[model samples]
Target chain A: MAERVLVKGTEAIGEAAIRAGCRLFFGYPITPQNELPEYMSKRMPEVGGTFLQTESEVATINMVYGAACTGTRVMTSTSSPGFSLMQEGISYMACAQLPAVLVNVVRGGPGLGDIQPSQGDYWQATKGGGHGDYKLIVLAPSTVQEAVDLTVLAFDLADKYRTPVVIIADGVIGQMMEPVTFPEFRNLNTLPKHDDWALTGANGREKHIVVSFDIDPHVLEKMNLEIVEKLRKIEANEKRWEEYKLEDAEIVITAFGTVGRIAKSVVEQARKEGIKAGLFRPITLWPFPYERLEEISKGKKLILDVEMNMGQMLEDVKLAVKDHARIEFYGRMGGVVPTPDEIFEALKKFLNV
Target chain B: MLMGQILSLAGMFEGKHVTWMPSYGPEMRGGTANCTVVVSDEEVASPVTSQAEVIVAMNIPSLLKFEKAVTPGGYLFINQSVVDREPTRIDINIVKVPCNDIADALGNLKVANMVMLGAVVEKTKVVSLDSIFMALEKKLTGGKASLIEVNKEAIKKGMEAAK
Candidate 1:
């Protein structure tokens, strides 16, 4: 087994990206996620990578688009408001089929609400904040170790599907510290070649053009249809979730990211008190584990949906269960995290035990 | 924040699951800067807890703010040098240690946090002192390397005072 090291979440993500052979990064500074770019700025040079602190988030996302067009592993990270600024570029990336990793260490916000952690951007990330009929593969990680693992996976998925991927983490995951074991560093020389589509001077062959715009409506519709096909395949293959103590669970809890892990404690406490409770945590918010959730929720007495926002993910939970089970929502908005005790209390009240 | 980080590293060295989360933003800027560290045999779930098994209150405001947060029969290490009043909680075990005074005796008041850490470790036995020394060596590197000896001495004094 690899030796474990104590590291902050943001730094762990940066290190994981480097180990995954990502050599280019472009980002703007934002609260909560500032450590990520700061870590990249220091580590990128050491690893012979480029880390550019762009003038703004708009500039940052465009830079990512440009770098990604070269078929290089590239990424940008920001907080909620800055993430909002990158929407137009993200839409363009989605349309152009560019491979890039975008991280949003989300904070409390409709607009710069606070620098504390929040999950208010769930709809924006999984449901496409950017304009257009498109989708970005969204991965939400609960722990620092998972954050590292998913960062590497994000690069792979982005390259595999030739589409942008978003790592939707909260401020708590961005700032927290945990022990993590990193994967072996990838050799840049052995990375998959992308010379087929990459614009590498064309050299006696046809010149490749990458653009999101087209004049004809019919042609654009065809392009949109192709994207839809790709999204369907991704949705079929990429849905990921975790089930804990679900075999005999009378009550099921659905949560993601930071709230998901916290709900695990509630499940443990509930079981200790003779309540048959379980936790179903969605790891992929975009390709939501709707089918598995529907399958597991059967015969469960109550389904509790917990989050750090005003019940954003509850909508998806409702969609998954779909009248099959009783669903309840417990949420705290504007960066207030719900504790395990309160969640257990809520669970006991619902169970009346 | 530093003490919380050290405890996390020590826990890791001891082959336990650990997480360290500090209060950020306004709470860290001249306010009662506090952190939560959870070390467990099983995978840790929440990084933040409403009730904690142990809490080291470094100042009066921190003590007053987190007094009720400690679980019943849990350890609450109070920095008695600065905090003039006694805690109101009766269920929790309170170990009042003069962290600042001990660090002052060790000729470096900045090691006050380390002193409090020693007291906590001595009382709770969460992590070994050797693991703490190892963590300190890793954390206090480069320009801060020279102060490790004084910090270790402060931790020893804190352990003795707790006894």
Candidate 2:
């Protein structure tokens, strides 16, 4: 058995990426997620990988784009504002069908907000952030161990679908240290070959061109249709979620990322007080587990959506439950992490207990 | 921060779930820096807690800030060497340790955190002393390895004092 070691979440994600056969990392320094690039810088050299601190987030994303075109595993990580800067690059990569892993250790948003944990980027990550019609497969992890697991999975998903995959974690998951046992390093020689679409030197064969745009409107429409088809396949297969103490639950709490795990504690607390509360955490934000949530909310009295932002995922929860369950929202905006006590109080007030 | 880290590591070594979350940014540079450590037998849900099972206050500001955060029957270990005030809360168990004085007696003032950690471990049994020693040996490597004996001694003195 692999020995368990205590590791910070940022460093763990870097190690996981390396183990997943990702060799190239390009990112700019950002608050709350600077440790990720720092870890990459030190470990990349040891593993014969390349780690480059680009001049800006814009440059970082484009560097990822260029490296990914060669079919090599590439990744970049940043926080809220830095992620905002990479949206255009992300759209171009999605349209070009380039595979790359992106991590956003989200902090307070809407500009240069405080360097504290927040889930304000839910809409940006799930819905399209950049211009055009493209969707990035988004994975949200609640625990440090889950963060490590999802990072490795992000690379695989990115490569499998020929699209960029994002691991959206909050500052709490980025800064926290936890005990984790990592999987064995993937042999770089054994990784999947992407020779079909990779921009390897055309060795006296038909040249393969990778471009996101075409002057002909009809050709562009055809390319967009292909992307839409790919997204539909992903949506069908990639939906993921978790249910905790939901079998006998009357009031179900729906959350994602950091808020999800925090609400788990609230579930235990509410259960201790005979409140019959449960937790539903969506692990995949883009291909959201809407059907599973709808199935679970069938007999539940209420579905409470909790978040670090002002009711972003609540829209999806409302859509899933529809009129089957009464919906309520409890959120703490601008980087404030709601405590279990506070969330329990809200639940009690809702039940008038 | 080191104390909380060592405790979390020791818990991991004991095959328990543990998480350590530190307060980052400018507040960690010169201001009141703090970290939260949660050790549990089951999977830890939240890394942050409004009420802690135990709180080690190294100074007066921390005691004043977190004294009320202790659960009714929780343990509150205060560093008497720096904190001049007494905790007004009568619901929790308070173990006052002169961490700086003990470390000074051990020929270094840097092991004061370990001294307070010793008191918490002896009182709470959160992790075994053997595990703490192992974690300390693992953490204090290279140039920092030579100070392990003194730190161990400070911890032993803290345990004896807590008794």
Candidate 3:
């Protein structure tokens, strides 16, 4: 049974990772996401797990790579800048097909922006910021409980696909406290079946090799094709979103993560004023559920894309809706979140309501 | 922050959806140190709220900053020991409770958050006083339970002084 408790997003993700059988965590401390590593540092030892704080984000992601290759469920947490440092490692892990869960509790960016929340990393997360041709199963959670649930889900998805999964959240989800019930504790004995590829010491069998590099161009192309196929399978099977009051709505608001939650409030406000406004919140940011959005846009009057950055997800929304519907945008940057009232006012002006 | 937890816990105790967003900066007091606790029947979308139905100001600056945000017919709980002036808004209901004085009289000034919490609960009935105590019992960890009695007294004084 899931026990309900008031939880901060960072703490919830940490505890959920532990419950999800994450036995190894290697992460450096960074603002907005420090609680995650701190929680792991305290709790991992209690559960006979390993929690290591490396010297830098580079070291941390590399450590996660090593631990995960050994068939251990490993994770790391960081903010925008720290995540940037780990991007190369992320790409390497993707090519290596290592299953590890990573979290970027996004803060203001471009530089060492403030510790406050911002969704500016949307493009980085969804568009494969690392390098090469690979994708991370990106999940954006709006609520603390969803953070816990998605953190657990991230591990399952990573292990199933033999790829990395990123729980992309913002500072609001990291810093805020809300009542959360964690998913049921998963036993460590029921861990993912990675024995065939895992680099456990060769006992009674041939030594296992976990390598990302291949000299033969055609062989490397085959490996790349395999990873691309996995992404396609994930995309087809794991598209998740939530639709609110879309049945008779004239206008729809599309958003994800923190801005998504605020946009829901705007939808509610618009409805209260007798406007037919609906909300479409994407739970799985990548494997971007464009098909459902296309179906929803069929007869809609307008689709407003509300995001934290000036407009990162705006391009994707436009691509989804195309000329099927007129797409508009409203966003705030640099850790300054747009309020529900502000968003509603913008909606009113945009729709002339 | 303590009061934020208490009220949110009380809301959860009442089966309401509760979310608290706290601000942390360099300065502790007299700075723009405040938090937003959204208690609603529906699933809350955003934790940040520009307008509040209630304002619980523990100090002068909080009152000065949050007073205008209160809705026309909402509630305002002011810690009179710290705030020397009346609210400028005429539309909202104001409950003046000297939380600092109440907690000091009960022997622990730190429980001022609890006192203000009690007044907010009493004035708005946002949660039961029993729920507040229950939340405190679970929260006031080892060695801290010893002070629960004084905090309870402070809450009672807050309830009485709110009107």
Candidate 4:
């Protein structure tokens, strides 16, 4: 039966993780995402789960590293600044090929930006937030419901690939209240077997030292090549994006995360006004659906890149369309949202219809 | 605000294509606070509702802030005690109920949400009382059982008062 209740987005992530069988959560409090750890504290105990509000973002990421090493489904959340502080651990986790979920409930800025929603992290998330040659699976969910669903899928995908996964959202999606449903527990299950690559004492086997250090340049290149090959396999298997009204579209808008949701509304309103504008929302930011975008933009004249920052994703759109379409950009920076009417206006300017 | 509340509320829909535009910040604490929940059977690319077809104005700020966003032929429900603003929009249907009074009479201020829920139930009829009750039971328990009963009473009183 269909049910409706109002809930904030951060709490939804915590609840979904618990239902997805995540047993451990370690996070430091940051604006917008603080609700996630707060929710975990109240409910994780009920499920006999572990929820710890660590001293710092660094400690939290290390905690995630520890739990993930034990093969436990674990997660941590932080805003942009804290996420930046966590980049080192995230890089280490990526190098170790740990299965864990990290949520970046993004806020404004290149540094200590205000606690307002912003998508400036687009490049950081998709281009590997940390150094070295590694990629983390990134999922962008625009609504409270998707926050729940995506967090669940993040764990599954992380385990399936044995790589870290990121739930990249903005403060707007994190703070909003919407109706969401938890699927029946039967459909979700956490794996009980992860000791092969994990560090559960090596179980009387050779001591497993998980590190990214090999003193040989040739070995480093081989490791990088192996990681690239794995990423290619993931791209082929998991690239996902949603298309709306593209078959007959004259102008297509590409957006992700919170801005994508607003762009969707603008597309619908534009259509009502007899404009042939469509929406392409990327659910998976990394392993981007470039092929699908290329195929869909075949007959389009213009592709509008909409984001919360100053056109970070526009570069990707240009690369995908390969100049087949004239690309335009519209963005609101420092946590401002482009409303449907604003997006519609942009569409009119782009298509001139 | 609670985990169960966030989970059960998010569970009502089944899709990634919904918009959840929430107007929240430090400015919301002192004044009235509200959010937009857009549930489309089809894919929703953006989820910001400036005006609401139905305004569950728990306080006056919610009513004044969102009442103008209502579509021409929409409905507005305000809790009489908390909302002191006069109705300015003549096109939308206005349903006023003493929800706070009802919740107060029921002996709990927290039940105000339930009272608003009852008012929403009557106007939108989006979900049945039994289902909402089930959600409540699933959301609240143990020491919270008393709260559930009070909230249920508030719902009943608001529904009857609306009638």
Best by DockQ: 1
| Model 1 CA lDDT for position B157 | 86
DockQ of predictions, in order shown: 0.87, 0.87, 0.76, 0.37
Which pairs clash (backbone N, Cα, C closer than 3 Å) in model 1?
none
Model 3 Cα displacement at B133 (Å)? 0.9
lDDT of 2 by residue, A1-353 (tens): 98788998999999999999999999999899999999999999999999999999999999999999999999999999999999999999999999999999999877899889999999999899999999999999988888889999999999899999999998899999998889899999987678888899899877878899999999999999999999999999989899999989999999999889999999999989888989999999999888999999997888999999999999999889988999999999888999988988888888888
Best of the two (2, 4) by TM-score: 2
Q: Which 10 residues in a row give candidate 3 chain A its minimum summed lDDT?
A: A1-10
Q: What is the TM-score of chain B in candidate 1?
A: 0.97
With a 3 Å backbone cut-off (N, CA, C), the pairs that clash in candidate 3 are none
* Ten-residue stretch with the least lDDT total in model 4 chain A: A183-192
C-alpha displacement of A113 in model 3, angstroms? 1.3
Which stretch of 10 consecutive residues in model 2 chain A shows the poorest summed lDDT?
A190-199
User: Local error of candidate 4 at A127, Å?
Assistant: 1.4
lDDT of each: 0.91, 0.92, 0.89, 0.79
Question: Which stretches in model 2 have alpha-carbon errors above 4 Å?
Answer: none
Q: Write the per-residue lDDT of candidate 1 for residues A1-353, one digit (tens) a residue.
A: 99899998989999999999998989888888989999999999998999999999999999998888888899899999998999999999999999999999999978769999999999999888999999899999999999999999999999889999999998789889999999999999987668888767789999988889899999999989989999999999989888989998999999999999999999888888888889999999999999999998887899999999888889899899998999998898888889999988887787777
Candidate order by DockQ, decreasing, is 1, 2, 3, 4
lDDT for position A346 in model 1: 86
How does chain B score by TM in each prediction? 0.97, 0.98, 0.92, 0.81
Evaluate model 3 with DockQ and give the value.
0.76
Model 4 ranges with Cα > 4 A deviation:
A1-8, A19-21, A46-48, A143-145, A176-196, B1-22, B25-31, B39-45, B56-60, B78-87, B94-140, B147-163
**Candidate 4 displacement at residue A177 in angstroms:** 5.2
TM-score of chain B of 4: 0.81
How well is each residue in B60-148 modelled by candidate 4, as lDDT tens digits?
76776777877888888888888877889899888998877887888787677777777777677655677667767766778887677
